[model samples]
Target: MSDFFLNIVEDEPQALSPEKVWKVAVIDDEESVHQATKLALANTHIMGRKLEFLNAYSAKDGLALLSAHSDIAVVLLDVVMETPEAGLGLAKAIRHDLRNFHTQIILRTGQPGYAPEESVITDYEVNDYKTKSELTRTKLFSAVYTAVRAYQNLTSLAAGREGLRKIIDSASTLFQERSIAKFSEGALEQINALFNINSDGIFCVSSAPKNPSPELAQYLTQHKHVDLSEVDNDFRVIATSTGYRDLFGVPLQQIPKKEVRQLINRALTTKSHVIEDHHIALYLDTPSTWQACIYLHSQQDITDKVDHEILKVFASNIALGLENTKFLTQLADTAYKDDVTSCYNRNGLMERAIPEVIDSNDHAVLYLLDIDYFHEITEALGFEYGNRVLNSFADKLKDAFPSDAMIARMHSDVFAVIVPGHGQPPIKRLIEHCSNQPLILENGDALRLGVTIGLSIHQEGTQADTTPESLIRHAEVALNKSKEQRRGSATTYDESLDAGSLERLNLLSELRRALSSNELELYVQPQVDISQQCKVVGMEVLLRWHHPILGNISPGVFVPLAERSGLAYELDLYVLRHSCSLVRQHPDLPPVSINLSAMSLDRGELLDDFASIMERFHITTKQISLEVTEGCLIKGNSALTNLQRLSDAGWDIHLDDFGSGYSSLNYLLRLPISTVKIDRLFILELKKTQHAATLLTGIIGIILNIGKRVVVEGIETQDQNDFVANAGAEVVQGFLHYRPVPFLSFVDEYKSH
Candidate 1:
């Protein structure tokens, strides 16, 4: 044996558990064999566990012994016993019948002829094969020690696999929690499952505590229970299996347990993990608002019982996950909370109220309040003053509604409230307060408010439409309906309000298809110069849609649809494309005026794109006239910028829809416009009212004084035509002279003339 144990020095024995022993079974036909095996292995030790031998002389006795003691680590068997294959039969029984796969079976033969075949060692559940003559003292010792050590390694591998499975399951549960409080509550249970430690745990956090009381915190922890008051303070026991949930507004050193405090402090100082004796203190890198620690009080020796490397990796992963979760939480606050008003924004309101409203199907009332003429207010005052007004408005709403009401700033100039329960909300009181009382600003300015409210009551049957977004929309529709009758009024949602919305949806879909198809046509209305004996001064191009199934669809129906559905830009491009094509065909036509929307004026192919299309059609600026409304005169707006570009390119600009918009006299002189068309509203007013001419005379004179031609529209009567003719408006356009004709038909008639 090469003197393997001649100078072996044994160290002091470990404080191991009594059950930690390597069990061995000695089975043979002879009594001398059992005595020899026992003497050889009596002093043997492997992996801190000494060999324990159980003896059975015959194969029958060995079978019984092996079956009874399943944990026996190794079996020494004689191949030739009372029967020729008796020892082999016992090996098969230990493997199949007893299902003792972990036990190592070593076969021995006294005679060379009795030695088992190589197949018996390879496939008959035998770990080793040896002859009795070769079984010296050293060989026997080496064999027993090696087999016991192999058994120990197999058990360790199985334990490690189980631990890894537990970690996977625990990590899955931990990763799903988004809030810090929720994550902390789950950590104890998950970690216990991960490490297989039967223990009580405490999760402490110092993050964002409210109304802290250090005295109460100390008393509660000492008493083994805490009320909600103690839980509201700092250094709180956020989660615990059994004991006080204290909250202390002090340092982490104020933790009640001395050993836990030491471990937590050590971990923080080293910026690493700390494990000791029967307790483990895991310091987590939480948000800047809080420092946290999970302290486990385990009864079993945990430090050396679990895998150290696996714990370190999971700890690192857990820290990374917490940091990520806190980051997302901050981002969520930014996304869902309004910065200017400190109210829940649209998304926040939806997330908070929708699910509850759906689940309860409770008697809930929704209120949408719009600040009437709010745009004009913002325009008159600066944007800074607008913010102050909004903040003051939000404060008044909070005062007006109940404390339990869920309120939010839905959008600019629009506020919402969701009141649950069957009580009548004090909405009338809120309106009167907003209207009669003056909102006092920060700089001691008192501004009178005009509030318009729309309400929707949701109950059991209406749960389908009780979604936050839908209810808010219904409330807004009612608010607009109220505004149509009066600026400051309240209205409740009705089923009739939905008819127009449904129609708009159907038309919007069809309009999208019309833009690409041949269903759209352009018509030109003649603007005649009165002084020149009704000579056509210019032609204004208007769009008309011809739906295949619906037959003539009016521009009034689809024009607003185009604007609302973001198809105005494309429709404007369609007009410009066809207008340039017309002037290309009929070169002798009067300057064709095509009305452009505010959106189209800014974003349409007016600058570079207009030039390119006109260049392609071989048309000049003199042949095309763009009609703009008062919206184009917003000084520094994109529409004005595009208008300046068109004027710079020598294209004639005409102010259309003049009296309908912000009809400022300043725009008449400041803008690069050559002609102005009075809206049809003034013409109808002139025929309906007594003093309408006075208004029309002054408006026409202003355009005339600016050296800009005035076109009086909707002059269907002879009296109306002569009235404008004498008023020196210069040009007049209406169905009385010529209804809008197709551009091609007008061109054909002009060519015939």
Candidate 2:
């Protein structure tokens, strides 16, 4: 040991080496203890740095000083002070309350009796515990030195955790609500941030699933030539004879593939991240697909031991974040999807289709489809089952068409599909597909559901105003014409269809005013219970609107228009309230059936409105039957919940048009409905089509099996009446039964009968 005196021959404080000074805080209750501790640790150099002593006389004062200087790194605490266990309390407070667990704590006690040896070491979350009397000058110095080194390790770990969190947050924000190009750019930026380095990166999704050795050889093209396929297990000098280090395409040799596969097999495994040499890999195991990220860097420092630990923590968080992002993306995509056919929805079409059409250099074909007589199915089986029928029909439409076709649900039982650069052959294939298959409902009933499709191709010389709305209108006109012919067939765009669609739009605008002006009227179609020898049971109300200028308008045209304009709710409510009032006015009338729109049911006010109307009219619940279609019931859980709510309100629930679209047998059990109406298509084709006969019989069997009553609609002939009666259908309604007439006309007809 050399005797040293204070020699202040030093450089300016600013010019002094930053590494030469270390600030040490000595905390003890006794002033003598602090002086003694400082004296013993004076002029000490553990790792080439001279110590400067800091003193705190009590635990309270020491904590205040510790908080002010978080970079102090190490704390020396005395166990006994004003309180017997002040040091332990301070340590607990720091670790839990102050969140300073990363800082090192060393406990020294002059009164050894106050601090138990084994308990203090184990129970308190301090770095070391010692008796101050036992701590020699050499031992004290050694303890302080050890504590500082440990704090450095903890600081590194904390920084790593924080860095990983920031990177994940940044990546997540970048990917959220982004386009494909932006997503690619964001991914590259994230990768650069992950490595803490600036580097150019490109991503390409290959047909091949696994990482190939050729990728590395391909990356180093400028350095050397190498054949990846020619060698196995043996290292071949590829790109660098220039002493450049090279690693395999995948990192994580420590986590052997066999071991990873075993870990994956053990349970529902999440993603894994691993590091090796100069690369970091991310592994994800999706059903039938294994996606991974293989990152490569030129510097060896990128995979240091400390960096490797940090990489592992980063990988775990990355896996979770990636999983969350992917799931969120899928969920967002589903929001813009049509559940039945898994096609784009109307919203999706409007967002994506118009832009695509605008960008097209070639002619694009737009085809709008309407399922002919779709109402008959929902009425026959109830909306719950009927929706399944529509879904089945939609599935057939999707399968029959090509994958590249941009298909969307434009409205209930209606679809608009866009085919870009579709020549005659592909369009013919689509037409053939539509012609080939009839949708099969869940009840094992086959619906030869006819589709009327309208096609419009934007020509090269046509005005560039081929917007999605215009294309949809063009296709719709063709569809209406095909429907008018009672044929489930395809029609290409003609100028006449465009003119007709424009007229239809004008008609819709006018129809909006019809409700307020009392232009709407109702006709009663008598529902005859044939089992009671053609006795009148209930009457179904049909809406008719006659424009003063346009003359008589079809419900088919105005009804859909009303639904689209968001006025269907008011129209439906008015009809129900008025219908109930009519029943009250004429005590001789039986229960009346009124068809409800899907949109009206979704409003959640239908039940309350119905209840109020019935209460006001002083009518019993048995006098009203609410008719709803199958398309309305199965849109989502909310729809099903609404149906349940309506059934609970005591109105007789009738499945308006059954045997039409997908009739979900499941809904019969879920819904509390009393009546199921057989569609008129089956009744109309009873004389000619064997397919129609089989479908009608199958639908009847399903209804009877579920204990629901059946009403066969569209009986226009004595033969049609005989056919429905022979099929064991309990009720029948049609023009032949008696054409729909006004209340006065109904009275006149009933009086004569």
Candidate 3:
């Protein structure tokens, strides 16, 4: 062995005083054989265990002795005693007959002629074979010591293998416990898998008295029944009823004492052993809040280097796993939760919440809310600011819904909430809240923001299904119906609303082909210069669609339909180019003003697209007037900028259908324009509503004062015409003169007139 190994073996203190020496067996029949074996092995020591010799004159006597004391490890036997193979027989008998597996048997021979060296070792089951003359003092001690060491290795390997098997089995058993009740029961099984040194009731205690009340954070060495104790804050005796006092032979030292404190402080700061005792191994972590110690029984001396590594790894994995489980659980909770709104995001609603709502047995009142004119806010403020608005709106929605209610963000500007055991009253309250809450921007701009809400009550046994998605669709239908009412109110979905939505869909599809099929025809109504004595100065182009099957559809229905379907730009371009062409073909016709939808005003392609079409028909910009409604200009600076771009591109800009939109005056002054065509609503009650007449007069005066022309639309009677003329309006265009006609009919009328 190396010097290091020799030092380790020598440093091991004696666990017990020199008691009854380990007995040795000598089995030989020769008269001097007994004396020779005793003389060779007498007063010998191997691994700190002394030797006491015992002689057996025959195989029978040795077997008898082995049966009495089963702990004998080494035996010296002579082979050529009674027969030439007596020792081999005795060795085999000891193995099979007595079953002394732990005993190491050695064979000794006096005559080499009877038992050859190689043959005896291979044939005999003894540990070693030696000639009687060569059995000297040192060689005999080496053989006995080598045999004892082999026996110790076998014992330790067997114990280690058995302990590992028990540990795996314990871990498997703990994995199967179904409830918390079995956790404490399984704890004993896990601890029992650890190697036990002696019969001290599975643990040991210190002799020193445990200072009952120690100072804060002082290390304590005491008998603790449970190492993983949360309730026992101080040190206490473990299993006192079992045998704490009897096994320890001394009381334990109390924690928080000055000596214990110093030990703890030293343990935390240094890498060396802070407490060297027979009971436990102490370790303190200064970088963290916890402290720990491992108890080692006196009989279980720490020999292997692997023990400390195992304990440290086990401790770290346990702590990390506990913390990881907690962190993951909290993270999962917040993942489904929306912090600002206290509602679910779309993913949570679709995956988790919808299943819950479906399982509910009670009737659910579902409301789908969409902010009316939300695009205006996004256009006025930036999108980032608009997101803040939406977040704030979501918070209000959460407040409006009950605590147990389910709410979700459905779309960009849409939200959905469900209330149990409630119906229209709650939906009405939500609508009122939406309408009443004025959105306050960061710039101190307050807007009376309103939302159109759709409500549907899904109860059992109804014709409609109560699935979450279906309920949302029903609510969306109601929202469309409410929007048609134009009051920012709540509406319930019904069969009629479904049918109306389908009809609108059909119309939208047909309208897609209306312009391409040449089904739409433009008709001009002359605006007479009554102030210039009935002379025609400008004509308003009124749109008329003649379906091949359905005869003349009103502009009011198809016009708005076309605007929403993105086809109004085509119709406006057609009217502007065709009207200008007609005026160029007939020089007597004045500048024709065609009514344009708000969508056309927003298109950057409007002016250039129109000029290209006019150039195709060989017409100048002065031949046609591009007219946009007051609603177009009311959309803020984008409308004004586009109008100014068109005017700068040499197209006449007229504010057509004036006095129809809210805040029209503000836009009228701001937009670039050449004329104002007063809406028929302002002129319909011109004689009946005196205030309408005064408003018209004031509007006309405002237009003329700005050096712009004023065309009073819907003049159906001479009296209406005379009323407008008397009010100093320069032009008049209405059905009293002519309704919209086909281009060929207008051509014939112009040629004949």
When 1 and 3 are scored with lDDT, the better candidate is 1
Ten-residue region with minimum lDDT total, candidate 2: 1-10
The reply for model 3, stretches above 4 Å from the true place, is 1-352, 421-425, 437-448, 531-533, 564-566, 573-589, 604-608, 611-618, 689-695
Candidate 2 lDDT over 1-753, as tens digits, reads: 000001111111123364755567777878888788888987776435677667787778877877777666667788788788888877777776678765667887876655555655545557677788868775576567655544543454434355555553464355353243344345545555765654432221111223333433453232223344432222111111122223222222322345332332222224454444554434433211213342333355455533554454544333333333333334345555776666788867767864586467467787787876666666556788767876776777667665666778877888877766754335556655665565677778776766677777776776645677766666776777777565667787677666776787788778767777767887899989888888998899988877888889888878877886688888897788778777887778767889988888777676777788788889877887889898877555555677788777677889877768767777677788788887787776777878888878788878888899888889888877877677778788998877888865786677687
Give the per-residue lDDT of model 1 (tens digit) for 1-753: 110000000121235575678888889988899898888777766656777888888899998898788788888998888988888888888777888777888889887856666666555658777888867775676667556644553343443456555654454466456565666666677777777778887776644322324643453344334453443234556567654355323346576668667776676556566777887778655323235567777878898765776665445445444544544455456566777897888877787665565466567888889897676566668778999999999988888877777778989899988877765556677789888899998898898889998987777765347667778888888887777667788998987877866787888989988887857999999888888878887899999988889999999888877876788878887898898987887788888888878767767466888788889899898888888888757523556768878898998988888879788887876778888889988888986777888888888887888788788889899888888877877788999888999988988877786
Most accurate candidate by lDDT: 1
Candidate 1's C-alpha runs over 4 A off are: 1-160, 195-198, 208-234, 242-291, 297-317, 353-361, 368-390, 410-414, 422-463, 468-499, 601-609, 630-649, 657-667, 679-706
Candidates 2 and 3 compared: the better one by TM-score is 3
| TM agreement with the true structure for every prediction | 0.65, 0.39, 0.53
C-alpha lDDT values of all predictions: 0.73, 0.64, 0.62
Best TM-score among the predictions, by candidate number: 1
